[model samples]
Structures are given as structure tokens and as C-alpha cells.
Target: MHITFEKLLYREDYQIKLDHIVMNEENGNRLALYFRGHTDEVMVLIGDYSCNYFELSFEADCVLLRSSDLHELDDGVEFNTIPLVLYKDSALLTFATAWMGLKRDTSRDWTHYAIRAFEQDFHVLSPRPPVFTDLGHKMSDFTVRHSFNLPTES
Candidate 1:
């Protein structure tokens, strides 16, 4: 089956109001992105629940913005605030304003899923679809279980 990034991460108005990001690499690799309500009262989560690898990058414009006038459009308004987008056949997900990217693992032979933001890139090798959830007025009730254990000597 073929899936587009926009379709995979679709919302009613096609808007993603990012709240925070959660990453873990214990039993397995997992990257969870949380979104807060802006136009509606629903919190959404888009995550690579089980992934092999991931990466991140930060751009200067995202970090060294001394003034809003740098990229202001008019009346102190800015375009591409979050600047989240998909590239490389929807395998690369990017958040330009944040300057980050996520993409699929190229070295792996298995199927892959990826996301990127500006220059920050993250890649995940997994056949499963991303974990998506929506809860209305229950933002505090969401949970993702991740645990860590030391490797034992052979």
C-alpha cells in the first residue's frame, strides 16, 4: 500500500500545532511528537512507535533569530511558523522553523519511514505505520511506555 505524508499526518484543517517532542532508545527506538489544540480541542500524536534509527539537525535561522523582523511578513506576522513538511517521496519530514529533518534509514534493506525538519533529519526503519492518537480535553491522560536496561556481557 502507498501512503502520502500529508495523508498519513492529516488533520481536519491540515494544521499541526506542535507542543513537544519525546524520544527514547531503550528496548527500541521511538519518537513521539505531541500537538496541542489550536483551532480545535483535540491533541494529536504522530510517532514512529518502533523504529531502527533516527536523527536531528538545527539551522541558524531557527536558533539565531535575534528579531522577528528577520522573516516577518507584515504586522509582525510570520510564514512557516512551524514549517513542517515532507520531502524525498514523503520519506523526509522536516520542520523548517525548528530546522530539523527525519528520514528513512538508507542502509537498511527493510521498509522505512522518515521525517525531517529544515536541516534536522530523522530516519526510522519500520514497516508499521506511525502511531497516531487523538484525545479531546484529555491531554494529561496520554502515555507512552519506554524502558531502558543495561546490556549483559556475553
Candidate 2:
């Protein structure tokens, strides 16, 4: 399953008004799988830009995720990392650690820190490598494939 935001609308005051959300899925499992896949990407992107952060809010049936206040090192280095806070309703689940980075920058100084809450019970499955393609200058694309096992009778 894949979801895309073809258009996004903002008010004159710079507030988010509406977003056109489109979902593509072949089955129920695929839909669920897509949601998980989407969250994984969001988390990774947020984790990369060390100064940028995101908050994920969930309602009864929908999830609201927002990223804001992007910052970077003063040396004019274009860092691609983000700080993230995960929330389910009013509960905080985890504070992202500096576990994400390119293979070369594996040192402690370049690594960001993360913290997890004791009250939350969450699981992040291993991520499969994404398929990336260049879409011309300054543009790129990513795709992740997912498969799941069928459930058995109780």
C-alpha cells in the first residue's frame, strides 16, 4: 500500500487547512502494512535532520503527524536529520535517539540521542532497504515493499 499527498492547502495565516490524502492498497493487510511503512519513513526523515523534530498524534481512527522548526549546524553544513517525539493521544512513547546516519558518520559527536518512555509498549519492526531513484536535479524518490504472514484460527 502507498499513500500520497498530491496537494496541500494552508491558510493565509500559515496554518494547515487541508491535505489531499490518497491511499493505494490491494488488501486489508496491505493497508495496515502501508501505514507502518509510512510511519517508518517519517521517523527516519525526522531522525536525520538532528535539529528538526516531529510530533505524531493519533485520534480514534486517524493519525496526525507534523514536522516543524527545522535547524542545522552553524557551519553551513547541510545535515539531513530530524528529532522526533512519538505520541499516542496525550501519551509520549519515545524520544528518538541518534541512531540514524550515513555509514561514514557513525561517530558519537554526529550521533543524536533518543529516549523511550517506560509506560508505552511499542514495537518497530526491522526496516527493509528502500528503493531509491533520482528524479532529476534536487529531486528523488523512495519506495518500500512489505509482505506479511496470514493469520491462523484462534
Candidate 3:
């Protein structure tokens, strides 16, 4: 399918492939998605750039975009690699901002870190999980591509 995101068309099976990775491939339920309801649309946090907003576009299509990065506007956002947090048995999103209103940066939420007025570093916090009644809905675009297994010690 050709996905139309930010006036660009991306022909890739993104959601299907991602769903498969999150469900069957991710071990020990360590994977989770960080989603934000941006206005009347939705976007999933997919990167860890402090100055760049890397997310999966859900406005009219599903594609990666650095919505806030002006430097890459001409070059276009890089969607090949995404930043993540490695866990003991799995990996997941680093952090994501919880959308409130168009307020000050102090209130904006992020997973990795947050910059304050006086502080140049981060105001770190724990990841806020969604209260999902149906857990399957989180990765509903289900599919089975490949299953990987490790060799056990004899």
C-alpha cells in the first residue's frame, strides 16, 4: 500500500510489519507503543532526538516524520533507523510526550529527558502506560512474517 504522509507517498507495509514485530517477535511483553493524540490525529513516538520530533504519522497515513526538525525539511526525515531502550528480554520506546495543550515546554512530556528553563539537562520520569481494557487493540494490525528462536544451552 502507498501511504500518503506529509505530502509524500511511501509504499511500504509499515503497520503490518510493525505489528508483527511487537506481537510475535518482542519477547516477554517488553515492547510497548507510546502514542499521542495530537489534535484530531494520532502519532506514535519513534525516536529520541531532543530537538527533533520523530513519530509515526497517523493523520492520513502511517509514516515516519520529524515534525519539528527544520534542518531536515529539505533532506526529508530519516525513517530507516529509530532509537529505542534495550531491556533484559525485550526493547521498547525510549520516551514520548503526553499531549496536553499548546503550553510551555516545562509541561511537555518526553521519555528520555526534558529540558527546563534553567537546567540544560533532563527532567527524567517514568513511562506512563495506557489503561487498555483490550490489550490486543494496541497491536491490532496483526500479521505473521517470521519467528526467531535462540539455541538453548545443552
Among all candidates shown, the one with the greatest TM-score: 1
Cα lDDT listed for each candidate: 0.33, 0.22, 0.23
TM-score of 1: 0.30
Model 2, 26-121: lDDT tens digits are: 322111211111224443332222111212221122222222211221212232222221222121111222232222333422122111211221
**Per-residue lDDT for 36-146 in model 1, tens only?**
333222322332222112222222111111123223322122223232322223211223212432223345222223332323323343333455454333233447777
Q: What are the TM-scores, per candidate, against the unseen true structure?
A: 0.30, 0.16, 0.17
Measured with C-alpha atoms, the lDDT of residue 87 in candidate 2 is 22
The best-first sequence of candidates by TM-score reads 1, 3, 2
TM-score of 3: 0.17
Which numbered prediction scores highest in lDDT against the true structure?
Answer: 1
Model 3 stretches astray by more than 4 angstroms: 1-16, 20-76, 83-101, 110-154
Question: What are the clash counts of all predictions, listed in order?
Answer: 19, 13, 1
RMSD of each: 15.2, 18.8, 19.5
lDDT by residue (tens digit), candidate 3, 6-62: 211122222211221122133333333332211111222221121111122111111
Clash pairs (backbone) in predicted model 3: 95-111
